[model samples]
Each structure stands twice: as C-alpha cells, then as structure tokens.
Target: MNLDNILYWFNEVFSSLIFIYMLFVILVYSLMLVFAFLQLRKDRNLDKNLEGKVNLNAVYSKPVSIIVPAYNEEIGIISTVQSLLTLEYPQYEIVIVNDGSKDSTLQTVIDVFQMEPVFRTVQNQLPSAEIRGIYQSKLHYNIVLVDKENGGKADALNAGINVSRFPYFCSIDGDSILSTKSLLQVMKPIVSSNGKVIAAGGSVRIANGSEIEYGSVLKSVVPNNPIVVMQIIEYLRAFYMGRIGLSRFNLLLIISGAFSVFSKEYTIKVGGYNKNTIGEDMELVVRLHNYLLKNKIKKSIEFIPDPVCWTEAPDNLKDLKTQRRRWHQGLLSSLMLNRGMLLNPKYKQIGLISVPYFVFIELIGPIVELLGYIYVILSFVIGNIYLESALTLFVLFLIYSTVISMFSILLEAWSMGTYPRIRDSVKLLLYSLSEVFWFRPLMVVFRLQGFWYFIRGKNDWGSLTRSGLQKKTNDTL
Candidate 1:
C-alpha cells in the first residue's frame, strides 16, 4: 500500500477499535450507575436517624479500636482525635499510632491530651517496628498513643492492630475528620451481619471549603477553587457510582484507608497489612479475598454509603498530581501482587469480575483513552481520516467523563445532602463539562506516569503539603 493509504488504514482500524472499547466501558459504567441508583433508592425512605442508639458503650457490644497512624501530621492530628472523641459510637477507643513523626505530632498530642505514661502490655501479634512507649490520655480513658519507629502507614497500622484490644479495629487517616455518626454508620453492616461481614468502608468526602469546628464538619460547602471543586465531583462519582455498585455483588477489592473497619482476627489471619506495598489497604483487601476464597471462608467485605469521612483534597495542581500518581501506582501494585487470582475460578467473583474490571477499566482504560485522544487530535489536524470517527470518539469521551460525573452530582443530591445548596451543585455540574477536555486528560497523563513509576520500583509514599482543615485549630484548642 502507498504511504497515504497505509496511514488511512491504520487510522481506520485504530479508531474503530477504540470506538468499540469506549462503548463497552460506557455500558459497564452504566450498569454500575443503575446498581448504585437501585441501592440508594432502596434505602431512600428508611429512617437513618433512628438507627437506634448506635453508641451504647464498650460493654454492650463489640467495642472498636480506632487506629490513627500519624506521620508528620501535627497540623491535623489533634483535630482528627478531637473529632473521634465526639463520635456517636460510645464503645470505641482511639489509638493514635505516631509513626515517628519528624515534627511536633507526638508532643502536640501528648501535651494537648495531657497524656501520661501507661504500661499497657500488647501481644504484638503482627510484625511491626519496635514501640518506644505507650501513653494514655488523662482526660479521656479511651484515648491511647503508641510512639513507634518510622515504619510507613501500613506498619503503623500493624502496630496499632497488635496493640488494639478489640475484635474490630478501624483504620482512619490522621488528616481526616470523621462525622459524629460516621463510625457508627460504617460499622452498621458489620454489626448487622453478626460476623458474616468482615470489613466495611465509608464514603470519603472532600472538606476543602466546608465549615469546621473542633474537627467536626459543621457545614458542607463546595470549595471555590475549581480544582478542588472538580475533586469533590470526582469523589462523588467514584463512591456513588463505583463503590456502591461494586459492593452490591460482593466484588469490592478496595476500601479507602481514610475510614474502613476490619475484623482484627481476619486481618491477622491474612498476615495483616503488607508493609512493603504503597497500596497496603488494597493489597490487604485483595489478600483477604484471596485467603477467604482459597480457605472457603464465608465472610465478605463491604462499602457503606452514608458514613462521611471528610478529607482534604489537594488544592493545587502539583500536590494533586502527586496524589493521583501515587494512587494509580498503589492500584497497579495491588493488582500485580494478586495477579494469580485474575480470571481464576478459585477466587470466584473477585477474580472473575472485580479483578478484570479493575484491570481492564481502571488500569488499562486510561492508556486506551489517551490513545483515543491522540488519534482524535491528529485526525482533526491531519487529513484522510473520517470526520465521523473523530466525532464519535469525542462524544464517547464526553459521555464517559462528563455525563456520569453530572449523574454522580445528581446522586449526591438525591441520597446524601452533602452539598445541599443549589448554587454549589450547579457550579459542580458546570465544571464537570470541562472534565473531558482538560481534567480527565491531565489525570490520564498523571496516571500514566504512575505506571512508569511502578515499573521503576518507586516505593516512596509521597507527601502532600497540607493547608490544615482549620487554620486556628491548635490555637482554639
């Protein structure tokens, strides 16, 4: 074939394949949206307020140990603990695992809570760094601190698990602020299941422009920053569209470390969190599944929708890029470590459905979409390609990126009143239009960078320079 004809044929074949793949992905995401809609619709009329005296103290039921692994979290550590203290769950103890903070994180919490030395012996069931000392708050009997050597977040969690006295332990991010009833809400499934459910995760909301007091989100307002607003929309879509749907069929592989409840027994049995992987939360979850299916355990992990774990989204592009890249890297690492389960009948739905979905849609989907974008650009500039093909792919990108996000905003409105104001919701809807053109492409590039980093064996848990949730938190406290 002539050079011109060769280029034409190549463009035709590539564009056609991309078009079909985009259609398939859209169909899949559409199904997830429907599943999410049904799930939310089913619980729409239920009296959530009357969840019935959720916090009844440690003696009444399965008391929980909330583990907050802090690494240089001086800015937000105090607020995080303060928020936990206000939790409606009455029977929970707060364990702040200070993972050798280089800053004043250890001293701040100690001085703030007037924590004194306490010689509480732990079984040390999990392998972790040596603990320097354990301290308990004089103000609150339930609050404890573990000062340990620097061993990353997973190791810190492992240390927390070893020291935790309860059957159920919650892993919460030190920089996050939990709603008063969030802990109770997240634990509802586990409590209701009576040991059938092993782990449960709550929805994480962005707290960028929200009103806050004493580590509690007093009011939920959408941030004015466009980037932060886009992240808010992304969170809405990811949790409502992806998580709710995946959890319905017991195919959930990831529960955010920001706020997730796990059975200490099951976690220990599966070898706790993998300290070596950046995606420790995901790796542990996949291992939990692998262990359960391989050993014929009947327990399941879940993602709960109502509980709100407010977290700070990276406001600027630089921090946001780092966060996204690291996230994608973690996702890839988890999938690779558990590659044996992929399409294997032994692991059942997790291997067959969840693994494939994450592999095809979550990981490889970005690269494919990136190619589609490139083709669309070249097709527009360089002649000989069909105009209709370019238009079709562009429309598909719009539907995939922008339309679903708008729907997620609608879902947020219908179910949870996180952003109740009409104007903020309208603003988010407006910004989502630009996602296909700008935001999504940027994410694809960043995520592609993550793939490169993963190949290079980059294991650093990159830090985000935080602008604390509440500027005057320490001074006020």
Candidate 2:
C-alpha cells in the first residue's frame, strides 16, 4: 500500500475513535445535567422552607468541630478562623492545626486571637505527627490551636481530628471563608438524614475580586480576570453537573475538603485521611464508600448544592497550572489506590459505575482530549476528506464545553443567585463558550502532566500563594 493511503486509513480509525469517545462523554454530561436540573428544581424552595421550620440555634441541632489545617498559611489562616467564628450553627468549636509553618503562621494566629499556651490533652484517635504545643484563644474561648510538626495537609487534618471534641467535624481550608449560614446549610442533610448520610459538602465559590470585611463576604462580584473567571466556570461544572448528579443516587466519590462535613465515627472507622496521598479529601470519601459497600452498610455521602464556601482562586496562569496539576495528580492517585473497586460487582454502583466513570472519563480524559486536539492539528496538514472529520470534531469539542458550561452557569445563577449583575452572567456565558479554544487545551496539557507525576510516584501538596480573603480588592467583571 502507498504511504499516503496508509496515513489516510490511520487517520480514519483515530478520528472515528475520537468521535465515538466524545459522543459518549457528551451523552453522559447531558444525563448529569438533566439530573442536576431536576434536583435543583425539586429543592427550589429548600432554603426558605427549611429556614422557616428549622432553628439552627436550638440545642436539638448537632454541634460540629470546624478543623482548619495550616501550613505556611499565615496570609489567610486568621481570616479563615474568624469566618468560622461567625458560623450560624448552634454550637461549634474552631480547631486550627498549625502544621509547623516556616513563616509566622503560628505567631500571627497567636497574637491576633490573644492565644496563650495552654495544657490541653489531644487524643490520638487517628495517626498524626508529633505535636509541639497547643494554644487556646482568649478572645474566642471556643477556638483551640495546635502546633504540630510539618506533616502534609492530610496529616494536619488527622491531627485536628484528634483534637476535635464533636461528633462531626467540618474541614475548611486555611484560605476559605464560609457564609454565616454555610455550616447550617451544609449540615442540613446530615442533620435531617437520620444518620443515613455520613458525609456532606457544599459548593465553593471563588473569593477573588469580591469585597470582604472582617472575614465576611460583604459584596459578591465576579472578577474581570479571565484566569479567575475560567476557574469560576470550572467550579460550576464540577459541582453542579458532576457532584450534584452523582449524589442523587449515592454514587458520589469526591467532595471538596475546603467545605465538607464528616461524621467523626465513620471517618475514624476508615482510618482518617490517608496521609500517603495528595488528594486526602477524595481518598477519604472513596474509602468511606469502600467500607460501606464491602460491609453491606447502608449509608451515603452527599453534596449539598445550597451552601457555598468562598475561597481564593489562583489569579495567574502559572499558579493556576500548578493547582490544576496537583488536583489532577491527586485524582489519579486516589483512583489508583482504590482500583480494586473498579467494575467489581461486589461493590455495586460505587464500583460498577462511579469508579469506572472517574477512571475512564475523569482520569484518562485529558490524554484522549489531547489526542483529539492533535488530530485536529494533523488533519489540516494531511488535508482532503480529513478536513471534514476535523471540522466535525472541532464542533463536537465546542458543544462539549459550551453547552455544558452554559448550563452550569445558569444553574449557579438559578440555584444560588451569586452574581446579581446581568453583565457578569454574560461574561461567564461568553467565556464558557470560548473555553475549548484556549482554557480547555491548557488544562488538557496540565492534567496530562499530573497523570505523568502519578506514574512517577510523586505525591506532594503543591504550593499556592493566597491573599487574605478579607483584603479589599476590585477587579470588576
């Protein structure tokens, strides 16, 4: 056969495969979007009715321990703690674990909260690194600070778990700020589920370019920065189309550590967070599922769409790439560690469905998508009928990003009303539609690098620079 003929046939097979794969992905996303919409429509009046009937201040409500793990978080730790102090829940204690920050994270927290060195016994219920000292806040009596050795985030969380004195604990990142009602809303499912829901998490919104005062989001505005705006779209897609749909049937595996609540009993039973992995939050959720499915226990982990955690997003491409790479790496590590559950009939939906979905779609998706982009570039060089195939594939990519992302943005607006301005929504709509051309390709490359890191046996908490959430800024969308 001629070389040109061989090239044509090879491109035919490869382009066909990309078409089929992209079609399957679009179908799945379509189904999830439908589920998400229905779920939101059903719970349309959830916040108002629940607020009217349920009193969060009553003793009948369960108290939660808010765990803030800090490592070089001097820039944002105090603000995070202050935000938690304003939680509208009936009772909760703030436990901040200072994971041996090289900076003044410990001292900054100490001086700000009027903390004094205190003798407090922290039970080693979960494995953790050694503790240097424990301090209690004099200004806020319920706040306890732990100075521990430099362990990664997962280890620091476990240390906080050991120190927490509540039946359930909420893990909030050092740079995260919660709305006053976030705790109440996130805990609503657990509080109402009659112990059936073991864990629950709320949505997270970018705090960049928003007005903040005293650790509270005084005004909500979309940032004009394209980098931060793209992240907002990504968050919307992940939470609205992904988790909310998965949680409808109890197959949800990943909930953000930045704003998730966990039952101490169940998390402890699963041996706490796995310090060996970069994605401890997801690993813990999957482990909880593994324990439940294997033991035939009837329980669920959930994602509540009502509450939102305001956290800072990296405002530059370099930092954004680092964060995305670390996230993708963590995802790969978690899935590989739990490969036993993949398509195993014994584990039912989690094994047969959720695990495989993440493995095939979420984990290796970037590689395939990268190949699709390559095929597009090569088709032009190879010309003729291949151009038709390339054009079709390009349109498919456009639909895959634009339709799904636009729906997510609309869902965010309909469900949360986060951005009141019409132009902000218009900006998000335009960017979501344009993502496949630029932002999506960049993510494809970055995530592939993350997959590479996982193969090389590298797991580390990547560094992220944070401006304190309370700092005033105006970058209008």
Candidate 3:
C-alpha cells in the first residue's frame, strides 16, 4: 500500500475510536447529570432534616477515639488538637501519633498540654516502626500522644489504630479540622443500621483563607489565589455530587483520608491500613468489603454529606502538581491492587460496576481523552477532516464540562447549602466551567507523570511544606 493510503487508513481508524470515546464521555456526563439531580433531591431533603437537627443532644452515641497521624506538623498540630477537644460529641478521646517528626512537634505538645508519660498496649500490629513513648495530656483527660519513629502515613495510622481503645476510630490528617457535629452525623448511620457499619466518610472543604479558631472553621471564605479558589469549588463538586451518588448505591471506592471514621474491630480484622500503597485510605476500605464478602458478614461503609471537615489546599503551582501527581499514583495503586474484583460477579455492584467505572473513567480516562483531543487538533491542522467536525467535538466537550459543574453547584446549593453567598456559589460555578480548559489538562499531565513515576518504582513519601491555614482574626471562630 502507498504511504498516503496507509496514513489515511490509520487516521480513519483513529478518528472512529476518538468518536466512540467522545460518545462515552458524553454518556458519562449525562449520567452524572442524572445522578446530580437525584443527589440534589436528597440534599434538599437532607438539608431540611439537618437544619434543625444539628443538635448533638439527639441521641446517646458510642464514644469515639479520634486518631490523627501527624508527621512534622508543628504549624498546626496544637490548634488541630485543641479543635478536637471542642467537638460537640459527648464521649471521645483524641490520639495524636507523632510519626518521628524532626521538628518540635512532641515538645510543643508537651509544653502546651503539659504531657506526661502513659502506658498503653498496641493491640494489633500489621507493620510499623518502634514507639518512643506514649504521653497523656495533663490538661485534657481525653487527649493522648504517641511518639513514634518515622513511618509513612499508613504506618502512623496503624500505630494510632493499635493504641486506640474505643469501639470506633476516626483517621484524620494533621492539617484537617472536623466539624463539631461531624462525628454525630457519621455515627447516625452506624447506630441505626441492622449490622455493623464498618466505615463512614464525611465531606471535606478547602480551608484556605478561612477563619480558623482553635481548629474549627469559623466561616466559608474563598481563597485569594485563583488556584486555591478553584480547588474549593472542585472539592464541593466532588463530595456533593460524586460521593453522594456512589454512597447511595453502597459502591463508594474511597473514604476521604482527611476525615474517615471506621469501626475499630473491622479495621483490625482487615490488618489495618496497607502500608504498601500510597492510597491506604481506599485500599483499607476495599479490603474491608472483600473481607466481609469472604466471611459472609453484612456490613456498610456510609458517606455522610452533611458532616464537613475543612482542609488546606496547595496555594502554589508546584505544590498543586505534586499533590495531584500523588493522588493519581494513589488511584493507580488502588485499582491495580484490587484488580481481582474487577467485573467479578460475586461482589455485585462493587465488583462489576464501581471498580470498572473507576478503572476506565477515573484512572485512565484522562490519557484517552487527551490523546483524542490531540488527534482532533492535528487532523484539523492537516486539513484532512472537515473543520466543523472538530468544532462540534470541542463544543461537546464544553457542554459536558459546564453541565457537570453547574449540576454539582446546584446540588450543593440545594442539598447542604455550604456556599451560602450567591457570589461564592457563582465563582465556584465559573471555576468548574473553566476547569475543563485549564485545570483538567494540567491534571492529565501530572497524573501521567504520576503513572510514570509509579512505573519507575519511586516510592518515597514526599514532604509537603505547610504554610498553615490562612491566618485571620477568625482563626479560632
């Protein structure tokens, strides 16, 4: 065959595949719209129920042991611990695992809370480094600190989990601040459910440039930087729209590591967090479900949309890229680790539905879509295909992006009403629409790099420099 003929044939095949992929993208967006609508309805109902029902006195709840895995978190450790002490829950203890910080993390806690040595048993251990000493807060009866050798976040969590004595435990990041009623919100499902509720995850918001008073977010204010501001919108859309729908179907793949509450027994049963994968939060949840399936035990992993936890976002481009790259790597790790469950009939929706959906859309969708876009642009440049076809595809992409962003905002406004100001909501809407053209492609590049890094077998836990939550007068509000 002639070279021209070969190129023509190849182009034709590629164009067909691109068209099919575009169609698939359109279908996913359309389904997201439907899911968004359903979620908005639920959000409306939840809002009505949640408005007057945030009262923590509603019921007697089980005591919770909050586990915060801290590694060199000197900037915010004291404040984060202070905030936990103020939570509205009646019975709870705070356990902070200082994972061999080279900073004054241990000393600061010791000074602030008048720490004293305490003895405790690490009941179950999968794998972790040595413990230096366990300290209890002289000021707060419920607070305790474990000084441990350097390990990864998963290892730190395992240490905390092993030390916790409560029936339920919440694994939280050092930089995260939980809502006063978040535990109550997550615990409700566990209390009412017929069987054990193994895990429950709550929504997380960006805390950049917000007033933080003693570890709790005082108000919702958009960050000054465009990147951070856009992240705020992204979190809203993700938690409100994506997680809510998945949670409804009992097929949520990840519980946010920022604020995920788990039953102590089930977590221990699954060997705690898998220290191997960067996506420890998700891998543990999937392992729990797999264990349940294996043992023929009925369980649930619930997601509570009303319970909000505020966390800091990357302010600069470098940090943002690193965070996104790590996230992509974690997603890849999680999917690869659970490959056995993909389309396996026994696990039902989790195996046949959620796992495959994540594998295609979330994990690998960016690579496929990016290549498709490149092909369309090249075809236009070569003047081979009609310009109208490329233009139509571009329009379709815009429509998909705008629709999902708009739907997510609508769902949030109707459901949780977190972004109360019209201006803030409008800004989020605009950012979501703009994400497709800007943030998404950058994400694609970063995620690709992540995949490459993982393939290259680079497994170092990179240091994340903290600027601390944006300081303002309302820092303690």
Candidate 4:
C-alpha cells in the first residue's frame, strides 16, 4: 500500500478503536448507575426503618477513636474538633495529631481545648516518625492530642493509631466537618454486621458555600463558582455511582480519608498506612483487602452513603488543579504498588474486576478520552474521513458524559435529599451539563499532568488553602 493509503488506514483503525472504547465505557457506566440506584434505594429504605427501631444509646454500640491529623491546618483544626465533639455516637474520643506544623496548629489546639502535657506510653504497633509528647484536654476528658515531629499524613495517622484507645479508629481531615449523625450512620453497618464489616466510608460533600453553625452544615448550598460547582457534580457522580456500586460487590479499593472508620487491629496488622504514597487512604484499603484475602477472612470494606462529611473544596483554578493532580498521582501510585493483586484469583473480585477497572478505566481513562478528542479534531482536519460515524460517536460521548453527570446529581437529590432548594438542584444539573464542554477537559489535562509527574519522579503535595468552615455560633462543645 502507498503512504497515503497506509495513513488513511491508520486513522480509520484508530478512530474505530476510540469508538469501541467509548461504547465499552458507556456500557460499564450504565451498569454502575443501575447498581448504584438499586443500592441507594435499598439504603434509603433501610435507614428510614432503622431510624425508628435502632437505638442510638444501645449498650452494644462500639466506641470509636476519631483521629484528626494536622500538618498546617491551624485555620480549621479547632472547628473540626468541635464538630467531632458533637457526634451523636454513643462513645468516641478525639485524638488530634500535630505533625510538626510550622504554623501555630499545636498551640491553637492547646489553647482552645486547654491541653496539658502528660507522659504516656503508646503501643507503637506501626513504625512512624518520632513523637514529641502526648497531651490530654483539661476541659474535656475524652479528648487527647499527640505532638509528633514532621511526617506526612500517613505517618501522622500511624502515630495517632498508636495512641488511640478504641478498637475502631476513624481518620478525619483537619479541614472537615462531620454531621451530628455521621459517625452513628457510618458505624451502623459495622455494628449490624457483627465485625463482618472491617471498615466503612462516609460520603464527602463540598462545603464551599454551605452555611455552617457550630461546625455543622446548616444548609447545603451549591457554590456559584464554576469550578466548585463542577466539583460538586463530580463528587456526587463518584460517590453515588462509582463507590456505591463498587462497595456493593466488596470491590471498593478506596474509602475517603476525610471520614472513614476502620478496625484498629486490622489496620495495625496490615502495617497501618503507607507513608510513602500520597494516596494512603486508597493504599491502606487495598492492603486491607489483600490481607483479608490472604488470611481467608470474611470481612468487608463498606461505603455508607448517608453519613455525610462536609469538606472544603478548592475554589480557585490553581488550587483545584493541584488537588486533582495530586489525587491522580496518588491513585496511580497505589495501583502500581499493588500490581501483584491485578488478575490474581487469590484476591477474587478485587483482582479480577476492581483492579482491572481502575487500571484500564480509572487510570488510563483520561489518556483515552483525551485521545478521543484529538482523533475527532484530526478526522475533521483530514477531510476524507468517516465524518458521519465520527459525529455519531462524538454525540454518544457527549451524552455519556453530560447525561450521566445529570443522572448522578438527580440520584443524589432523590437519595440523600440534600440541596433541598429546587433552584440549587437546577443549577447543579445545568453545571453538570457543561462538564463535557469545559470542566471535564480541564480535569483530563490535569490528570494527564499527574501521570506525567509520576513518570518523571516528581513528588509534590501542591498548595491547598482553606477558607475554614462557616460557624453560626461561638459556643464551645
């Protein structure tokens, strides 16, 4: 064949491959959506029935240790602690780990909670950075503070784990606020399952424009910023469609670090969190799965959609880009490190389905989608291409992106019943429709950069600025 004919054939084949990939993605996404919808419906009904029957003050409820790891979270630590103090769970203690912040993070906690330094021995099951001291709150007996040398989030969590007194320890971000019933709801599955559920994750909602009262979100408002709005939609789609479906099959690999309850014994046995990777949350969950499968333990990691943890989302483009890139990098790192589990029958569903989905659909999805975009442009420029078929595929992709996003938003509205204002729901729907045109492409570029950074051996956490949760009252918890 001549050069022109070969080039033409290459374009056609590439375009055909892209079309097939899009079709597969759409099919998988539709399946996930169906699974998610059924799960959400079931959970909603279960929650409704349990609300009247289940007693919050039941004697059998297990105590949890809430761990807040702070690096430079001076601005939001106090409010976060306040939110923790108000949890409706029967029993829990707050342990805030100060990871040697250059800012006055430790001092702020000490002053606010009237912490007194005390010499106490820790189990130190997990290896971590050096500990400076441990403190107990003079005002609140249940609260404890750990002063530790500079370590990343994972190290700080491990340090917290050493000091935690409860069997289950929950990791909460310093900039996050949990609803009053969040802990109770998240722990419900574990309690009901009789230790069959090893870990449970709660839904994380963006708190950019929401009105907060004493560290509790009083109203859930969709932020006016285009980026924040896009992220709000993204979170709904991920948690509702992606996580819920994955968790149903016992194939969930990631439970958000922002608010997740984990069994302390299992966490320590699995070597706590991996300090080396930025995606410690995901890495730890995957490790837990690996450990359970190896030992033939019949425990599960669950995602509880009703327990909401409000978190601050990056409003500016720079901060948002940094966050997305770092997240993608962490995801890539976790998958690479656990490559042994991929297609390994010993791990069952996680190896056969979850890992492959993450590798092909989650990890390389951005590259493929980006290539699809490039192919469309090239086909247009090169004229004698299959124009009609190309346009049809493009339309399918557009519908797959925007329509699925809209459905996710609607699912959130139907299931969670948050964003009560009809106007807010409409706004989210409109923003989700625009995702295919602008926000998705931008995220695609950011994720691609994250892959590049990983390949180039660049390790940067990037900048994350917090505006602090809005407080309606200055009341102390």
Q: Against the true structure, what is each candidate's TM-score? A: 0.97, 0.98, 0.93, 0.96
Q: Which is the winner by TM-score between candidate 1 and candidate 3? A: 1
lDDT of 4 by residue, 1-477 (tens): 999899878877887888888888888888999999999888677655467247576514589999999988988898899888888777889999999999999999999999999877799799989999999999999899999999899999999999998999999999999988888888878887889999999999988888887777887888678888899889998999999989999989999999999999999899999988889999999999999999999999999898899998998889988999999999999999999999999899999999999998999999998987777766677666557656866787787789999999999999887799988999998887778778888999999988989999887877698778855422211
Query: In model 1, which regions exceed 4 Å deviation?
Result: 54-59, 472-477
Question: What lDDT score goes with residue 156 in model 1?
Answer: 97
Mind giving the per-residue lDDT tens digits that candidate 2 earns over 1-477? 999899889987988899999999999999999999999988885666467246564424578899999888998887788888887777889999999899999999999999999997788989999999999988898999999999889999999999998999999999999998888888877877777999999999999989988889988888889999999999999999999999999988899999999999999999999989998999999999999988899999999988889999999888888888999999988998999999999999999999999999998899999999998998888788899999999999988998889999999899778988888888899889779999999999889889788888877557877777868887874
Query: lDDT of all predictions, in order shown?
Result: 0.90, 0.90, 0.79, 0.88
TM value for model 1: 0.97
Measured with C-alpha atoms, the lDDT of residue 289 in candidate 4 is: 94
User: Model 3 — TM-score against the truth?
Assistant: 0.93
Candidate 4 local accuracy as lDDT? Answer: 0.88
Model 4 pairs in collision: none
Q: What is the lDDT of residue 181 in candidate 2?
A: 83
Query: Model 2, residue 232: what's the lDDT?
Result: 93
Candidate 3 lDDT, 260-328, residue by residue in tens? 898888888888888888889989988888888777788878788878888878888888888888888
Q: After aligning candidate 1 to the native by TM-score, how far in Å is the CA of 80 from where it should be?
A: 0.5
Best-fitting candidate, scored by TM-score = 2
